[model samples]
Target: MAGTLTVWKFPTETGAETAVATVRDLRRRRLITLHDAAVVSWPAEATKPKTRQLRHLAGIGALGGGFWGLLFGILFFVPLIGAAVGAGIGALAGALTDVGIDDKFIEELKERITPGTSALFLLTSDAVLDRVLDEFRGQSPELISANLSHEQEDKLRRAFAE
Candidate 1:
């Protein structure tokens, strides 16, 4: 099966960074395959934070790059009252919604991940869920899984929404 695009929101930047590093360790041990990964950290003082693309993972292509770019664009580039620009971006985001990532989700994430928080965006496969969860047991991160069926997504959400 193709891997799912998963976003895990961590309450702290350190928690998110730790998750990414642990995933990297798993990848190094050949336990999982990470297609691409990025980390977003928004400090309380900064207006916006950069979404950093990890170096060791495979290419995420233009679609993934554009998706993240558009997210950051909406958060930092578009003017607050630029209806025309907002509509254009909305249209583009709507078009890409079928691709499994969209503006609505992005906006929801924007609301959920506030300043002083962080998130991990990962494209992964062959994950050992037990092991992965073990690494994060103490952190209690919130998960927002994408590219999954409604049932699957619901199950995942219920499992990690703590």
Candidate 2:
């Protein structure tokens, strides 16, 4: 089955880190199948976000550090360098687009995950949506983006609304 790439934004800098435990629990319960996960935490006083890949939890077919590095570079570093590195960043962004993470998704992430906020990036498949979402009821995470069909996305939005 195809995996879904979902990004969830949280209001607090530590929220994404806390959510990792919840995701682990869900995986343990067989409610979700996680291929890989990463957390991006940006503190209010920091100049840039801190990224951590859940290497211990990575399963087969997981994306390597290079993928995450290139993506994070495009999202957080490319703009800072201005036009000098535009060509290189463009090629990296294009590679990400080839894998379903397009410019719109990157832009939205850059806009939403600002200082004092955090985001959880999940590569997963075969989720028991209701059960898994129930585990995150009180966290108030916003579903920023997802590689899901229109119907699936609508269902996810409705679930979050509930």
Candidate 3:
């Protein structure tokens, strides 16, 4: 099921940073999917812009701390549980880190945050627009985009065009 669309405007200097932060923020909000997002404007990468955009890291501190803390808690109360869970998590994180895209992904994300761009976050879910929009509106970023169907995005676009 789906509901009316909503969007949020978070100021940033780079479109790349906006994408990263939007992904991270929505995920934290328990959103599992994003319909679409585009950088309407971005400073040419070759020329560094003077304005700086606010940045957000995905599952960064919270995710990191939660992962490690879970292991510690289990380890403290249940040695076997801790050992198994800790090893599992460590391995997954390691594998993801070892993957070729790990460094590049991080570097790219870093590049997005440099300055003076804004990120528009698009969300698709069953929840009411006000439920989410109210929260972001309170934060007052830049502009929020809502309810993006491929049909609406491009008159000729079909459901599976992507």
Give the per-residue lDDT of model 3 (tens digit) for 55-126: 233212122233223222332223345676666755544443422214343344334433445444333444
How well is each residue in 75-160 modelled by candidate 2, as lDDT tens digits? 88777887968787897677565556778888889999999999988878887656766788898888865565544433433332
Stretches of model 3 off by over 4 angstroms after superposition:
2-6, 14-19, 44-117, 121-123, 127-139, 144-160
Best by TM-score: 2
How many steric clashes between backbone atoms does each model show? Answer: 0, 0, 16
Model 3, 136: alpha-carbon shift in Å? 4.6
Give all candidates' CA lDDT scores: 0.67, 0.78, 0.38
Q: Write the per-residue lDDT of candidate 1 for residues 1-162, one digit (tens) a residue.
A: 455777788898666887877787777888776766778887878777657767566433312454556656675556663888788987766644555566667777878777788888776767766677676778878887667445443443333232
The C-alpha stretches of model 2 lying farther than 4 A from their native spots are 148-162
TM-score of 1: 0.75
Q: Which candidate has the top score in lDDT?
A: 2
Ranking by TM-score: 2, 1, 3
TM-score against native, each model: 0.75, 0.86, 0.33
